[model samples]
Structures are given as C-alpha cells and as structure tokens.
Target: MEQKEKQILVSIISSIVILASYSLYVYHKFMAGNPGIINDFRFWGRAFLILIPVAIMAQIIIHIIFAIIHKIVTDEDLSTKNDERDKLIELKSIRISHWLFTLGFFLSMGSQAFGKPPWVMFITLICSGFIASIASEGAKIFFYRKGL
Candidate 1:
C-alpha cells in the first residue's frame, strides 16, 4: 500500500459517501415535499450550502483516517517524499481530470440550454466534480500500479 494508493482509496470512498448522503438528503428534504423542489431556487441554495461544506469536511476526515491507518500499518510517516516519478504520475492524473471537468462544464451548459431545471444543472455540475475527482484519483492509482 503506497501513499498514492491509500489516497485514491480515500478519494473514491469519500466521493461515494458524500454523493450518496447528499442524494438521500435531497430526496427526503426536497423531493418528498408536497409540490416537489425542482423549480425552487431554495433547493439549489440548500444543496450548495449543505453539499459543499459537508463534502469538504468528509474528505478532510477521510484523509485523517488514511493517515492514521498508514501510520499503524507501516510504522512510517504518512507525509510521503515525492520523487520525480510520483510527480509525473500526479501530473498525468491531473491532465485526465482536467478533461473530465471540461466535459462536465459543457454538460451543465447543455442541460441549461435544453431548459432543464436549475436542480438538474446543478446536479450535473456536482456529479461532474465528483467524477473528475474519482477519475483523477483512479488514474493515479493506475499509474502507480502500472509503475508510473
């Protein structure tokens, strides 16, 4: 278990947790309402206000858990010393993530152009961000496994 692999694991887990929890929350809080919430700007506001901070906090906690696990497993510091190959792997992963983000942005725009609800567009954007993150972290793990 390399540092990057641990990081990728944390990232994927965090994405799954945050997205699933937010989706469930939205379903219960907004979708379960009498008239529903698709057209409501308050829906968008609440989603943003809740999801962003919650996701950030979840990631922070997940990283700390990974750090503790690494310490216990390897008896080594979690702060890894990055070498040239590590840097290259990270750069390549980021390149892939950038493309995903660009695509997601366009998807959001297309949704809006088709007269989709604000909630739908925001969902597209949020999903894209999550996908971008997972793809980047997955690429990093792949590169690590493939020997950079």
Candidate 2:
C-alpha cells in the first residue's frame, strides 16, 4: 500500500478506536452517577481536550509502526513526497469532507435546539466531525486505489 493510504487507514482506525473507547468509558461513568461526565459541560470540555491528543498520538504511533513494517516487508523506504495526483486526491477528499462537516454541524445544532443535554450536544458534534473525517479518508483511499 502507498504511504498516504497507509497513513489514512491508521488515522481513521485509531481515531475511531479512541473515540469509541472514550465514549464507552464516559457512558460507564454516566451510568455510575459520577458527577461531571455525561451532564457537565466542564467534563466534556476536558474530555475533548484529552481526546484530541490521544487520537493524534495514536495516529502518529500507528503510522510509524506501519512505516517500519512496510519498510521491512518491501525493503524500501516509504516516500515522503507527494505528487500532483496525490494533492488532487487530497483536495477532492477535503471538498467532500467539507460538505459532510456542514451537514453534520447543522444536525448537531438541530439536536442542541431540540433540548438535548450538554453531553448529547458534545457527542453529536464530535461524532459528526469524526464521521466526516473518516469519510474523507475513506474517499482518499478509494481514489488512490482507483488511480487518476
């Protein structure tokens, strides 16, 4: 697999895993009646901050591991350079992702307006964004395999 595709795969998978794990943990806390997790704005704010880094680090580590394994298997270094087609694929993916985000944002806002709690709003926003990103990455991988 190409380096970019590998990176995208790692990023999407890692982000999903991290988000799911965090959500499950918070849900458990909510069920246990732990204060400031599912109902508190402050808790969500802190959780968001923590989640960002954990997701980012997971991507970085996964990407590195994939690179090392790819090198060992292929006996060649993964190229860091991107070509024109790569840039075009990225742009197209981002364009689609933008639409996804806009749609998701509106949905999130609608949920907020419908009197959902803070935690619900938080999950809606985060999940929409994550879905958008995953969709974009999936598009990139598809385009890469499809070629120019």
- Identify the candidate with maximal TM-score: 2
TM-score for all predictions? Answer: 0.84, 0.85
Number of clashing pairs per prediction, in order: 0, 0
Q: For candidate 2, which ten residues in a row score worst on lDDT? A: 29-38
Report the alpha-carbon TM-score of model 1 versus the true structure. 0.84
Candidate 2, residue 72: CA error in Å?
A: 1.4
- Candidate 2: residue pairs that collide: none
Judge candidate 2 at residue 54 and give its lDDT.
80
Per-residue lDDT for 110 in model 1? 97
Error of 2 at 110 (Å): 0.8
